[model samples]
Target: MEKRRIQIFDTSLRDGEQVPGCKLNAKEKVKIAKKLEELGVDVIEAGFPISSPGDYESVQEISKNISHTTVCALSRAMEKDIKIAGESLKYAKYPRIHTGIGTSNVHIRYKFNSTLDKIIDQSMEAVKYAKKFVEDVEFYAEDAGRTDNQFLSKICENVIKCGATVINIPDTTGCCLPEEYGKKIQFLMENVKGIHKVVISTHCHDDLGLSTANSLYGIINGAQQVECTINGIGERAGNTSLEEIVMIIKQNPHLNFFTNIKTQCFADISRLVSKYTGMKIPANKAIVGINAFSHSSGIHQDGVIKKKETYESINPKDVGVNDSSIILTARSGRAALKYRYQQIGYFLKKNSLDLVYSIFLKYADRKKEITDKDLETILEKANLIKNHSSRLSSDISRHVI
Candidate 1:
């Protein structure tokens, strides 16, 4: 079967920088935008141009600097916002105006102070207005996860008719489960008229920690584009981690979905975002975390040492890290000890390995972990090397006599 190419629409600069203290200046955003392009994202959502002068400049600057990747500017359903968004991307070779309105009843009434009919009218008008400035237009149905599927399908069909090249169904609050989100996308695929004429995209948040799952489910059901951030930085919890979803696609070839992302650049870009945003990556965070490829448990270390595939489904190098680690602690088994010995140029036989492991356990109990120097001391104290040396000398003397 032919693999489908999934467009990676990175919103790190716009949505990721939305975290209260994680804001980046125009220069900083351009730096990250260039890196995102180098990392092979299909589209970069530079900023919400109508939000502020800083954002407008960031989008304009990014659009000017980036030539290959499509640069996008976001806007609300308002005419003024869409006009500003269009102006921000005037310099972009490939530009898209992302404009939309809320679809769910909650947003229609509480957020917009309007009804669904009005919201649909606004959504269509927004797309039509955006199409004036650029050939590419993305219409987002904000909170579509909770919107009535039939109504959502009508909105998508109408927006496409209004000349939207892509329809973004965002799980704005991250409230829906994978099954629910998948069904919503599937419903659109089956119900929306002229669905095949435009790309269906996903924009999911991590409020419930299921953004990655939900996004992938949408792809499985029919979505062709995914909106994500570098380290899941965004409102409330965060958006989907770009590296996570990309790696998931890479590891699961059976799904026949692939992206243009340079997987090896994930770690570098992850650190760059973390450093600039001042958001620390958790130790257990998947893919690019410090402990993502580190092993400490006895059984786990043994399995990893024998065959990495036994314990790790994804190779550390595949995600840009240099290599995996075998952490030596009190719980480390004989296999770990043997591997550590070989690391320092000692190849212990099975008999000698057992002896050294006995000494290692006692030494490990008194200490937190055995470093290379500590292991060398343990090996010397075990007397196995001395015994072998003594036997060699005795054999030499016998032959000489």
Candidate 2:
């Protein structure tokens, strides 16, 4: 089967920087934009141009620096926002303006205090206005996860008619189940008129920790584009993780979904984002985390040591990591201890190993992890090398006699 190309719309700079203390200056934004281009992102959402002068400047700077990927500037469904977004992207080889309004009833009632018909009019008008500046305009249905399917379908149809090339259905509050989100996409795909004319995009939040799952289900149902951020950094609980979605597609061949992302660049970009954002990637984060490929459990260490595939589904090297790590801890067994010892140039016979293992258990109990120096100290305290050398000499002397 032919694999469908999933467009990777990386909003790391725009959405990711929304996290407090994660703000980047224009220079930093440009640097990351170039890296995103190198990482093979299809689109880079540079910033919300109308939000601030600094953001507008960053978007313009990114547009100037980035050429291969489409540079995008975000805006609310307002004329001034769309105009500023368009002006900011004038230097981009390919530019897109992402504009949208809240579509859910809760948003309509509490946020806009407007009727559904007026919201659709505003959405279409925004898409039409954005179209005056860029050929590629993406319309977002904010909080569409909670919007009525029929109303959502109506607004999407209107936007496409107004020249929206992409329709983004954002689970704004991250409140939808995977099945519900998927069905929403399916509903749009089945009901929205002129839907085939525009690419359906999924923009999910991780408030429920289902952003990746929701995005995947969106793709399965029909979305061709995914809006995500590096390290999944964004407002509140953050957005869908670019690495997670990309790797999931790459690892699951049966899904027949592919992207232009360079899998090998995952580690570098993950670190780059973490460094600049001051947001540390959780050690247990799925792909790019420090402990993703580190094995410490006795059974897991043994399995990984013998065959990497036994414990790791994804090779560390595939994502730019050098190799799997064997973390030596109190839980580690003989196999792991022997492997770690061999790495540090120690060979032990059965009796010698037994003596060291006994001491190792007692020593390891005092620490969370055992380092190579600690292992060496334990071996020296046991005096196994000296004893083994004496035993060898005695055997030779006895044989000669």
Candidate 3:
């Protein structure tokens, strides 16, 4: 089967920066953009030029430095916003103007306070005006997750007709389930008149903690591009995490899609964003998290000790992570304990394990984790006792401290 290639549009510098305290300086933004380019993103949505003067400079500086990835500037449907976006990317070799407005009735009525007809007209004008600046124009419909399927389809159709090279459907609120979001993409693929003229893209949020799932679903359905941020940092919960989305498609064969991302760079990118943004990644975060591949339970640890493939779905090396952690705790099995002991040069046999039980009890009483160093010290004392007279019996009964 032929695998479809999905364009990864990294929004780490733009939407990811919108998160509180995640604001990066122009220097930081340029630094990240260079890394994003090295990570092989198809496009880097640098910043919203009209949002602030700082944003404009950051986008411009990023555009000047980035050579391979297409530099994109976000803008509202207003002419001023699109103009600022174009001005910001004047030096970009491959520039794209990503401009759009809300297409959902809720946004049309409550947010924009305008009629649907006016919404379509304004969206078209934005795309057309943006075309004057750059050949690549991407149109986005915010809150596309909750938008009426038929109306959203029309917005995509007209946006493409107006010269949008790509149509971005954003689940801005992360409100939809995976199945519903998938169906929504399928609907756009089946209904939009001009859908074939432009690539369909997905920009899903993680408010409900399913951004990566929904984005993958979009790819599985029909979305040819995915808008994501490093470490999943963005407004609210976040946009689709670039690491999560990339790992998912790589690990799941059923998705039938591929991207150009350098998967091995995933960890470094996550760490860089987390450090710059000051938002520490959750230990349970997919792919790049510290505990993503950690095993502690007895059954799982035993399986992992037997073979890493038994417990881990993806290889740590693939995503630049060091290795799976075989954490030792009360739930750890003898096999894991033996494996850990061997790591410290202690090859304990069954009889030796019986002797070690008393030491284990003492160690468990005082500490939650029995470090190899601690185990070695305990054994060293035991070996001294064996030489003294008794065969390292619990006669001395020193605490496992």
Candidate 4:
């Protein structure tokens, strides 16, 4: 079966930068834009041009440097915001103007203190004005997660009629369950007129820790584009994670959804974003996390030692990680201990193994885990192993074979 391609619309620069204390300058923005281009994102939302002169310059600079990737600038429903966004992308080879307004009742009644009619009118006007400046215009209905499905359909229909190349339904507050969000997308696909004419995109937040799940469900329902940030950095709890979304689609071929992202660049891009943004990735975080492919349990280590597929769903090399780790901790089993010993060139016989295990538990209790050097010390004290460094060299050579 032919697979459907999902456009990865990365908002790391625009939305991701909204994380408190995680700001990037124009140079850094351009740097990340270049990497995103290399990573093969379909679109990079540069910044909100009308928000500040610095943002405008950053968008302009990113537009100037990015060649293949579409450089997108965000704007509000106002004319000034749309015009400034357009000017900021003058040098972009593939420029898109992303402009929209709040569509939820809460936003209309309280945020804007206006009626639904005015909000709909503002949305239509914004898309129409943006269409004049750029051929590729993406309209986002902020807080669409909480908007009424019927009213949201009307707003989407009007925006599409007004010339929006893409319609973004964002879970601005990160307040919807996966099933609810999926149903919302399905409703838009069925009820919105001209829905098939433009791409339906999903921009989800992780406030409820459902951003990735919500995005996946949106695709299954109808969305063809995913708006995500590297390492899930964004406002509040952050946006959908790019690595998680891409890996999910890749690992599950039956879904038949694909993105142009080079999966091998996952680790590199995650590290770069973490370094520049100063947000250290959690060790247990999925995909790019340090312990994503590590094992410590005895049963798990035995299974993995016999066959990696026993415990691992995805290979380490698939996402550019060098190798899977066999972490030796107090919880680890004898199988893991044996594997660690063999890895460093200490081969213990079954009779000697019980003795070594007894000593290992003592040391393990004293230390949080065992290291290669610790193993060597254990072997030396046992007086059963010789020439640790020479044996290690031979074991390394044997591994290469």
lDDT of each: 0.90, 0.91, 0.87, 0.91
Candidate 2, run of 10 with poorest lDDT: 392-401
What's the TM-score of every candidate structure? Answer: 0.91, 0.96, 0.93, 0.95
What is the C-alpha lDDT profile of model 2 across 24-58, one tens digit per residue?
99998898899999999999999999999999999
Q: How do the residues 198-271 of candidate 1 rate in per-residue lDDT, one tens digit apiece?
A: 99999999998999999999999999999999988888899999999999999999999999999999999999
lDDT of 3 by residue, 1-401 (tens): 89999899999988988887667999999998999999999999999999999999998999889888899999999999999999999999999999999988889999989998999999999999999999999999998998999888887888888899999989989999999999999999999887888898999998998898898889889889999999888998888989888888888777678889899998898898898889999999889889999998889999988899998999999999888988877777778877777775456767676676666657766788777667666676556344322344443333322
Give the per-residue Cα lDDT of candidate 4 at 380: 58
TM-score result, candidate 1: 0.91
**Model 3 — which ten-residue stretch has the worst lDDT?**
392-401
- Specify the poorest-scoring 10-residue window by lDDT in model 4: 392-401
Q: Among all windows of ten consecutive residues in candidate 1, which has the lowest summed lDDT?
A: 392-401
What tens digits encode model 4's per-residue C-alpha lDDT throughout 1-401?
Answer: 89999999999999999878988899998999999999999999999999889999999999999989999999999999999999999999999999999999889988899999989999999998998899999999999999999999999999888999999999998999999999999999999989999999999999999999999999999899999999998999899999999999999999998999999999999999999889889999899999899998888889999999999999999898988999998888888988887786566667666777877888888998789888877765665556565443222222321
Ranking by TM-score: 2, 4, 3, 1
The TM-score obtained by model 2 is 0.96
lDDT of 4: 0.91
Residue 393, model 3: Cα distance from true site in angstroms: 13
Residue 121's lDDT within candidate 3 is: 93
lDDT of 1 at 313: 97
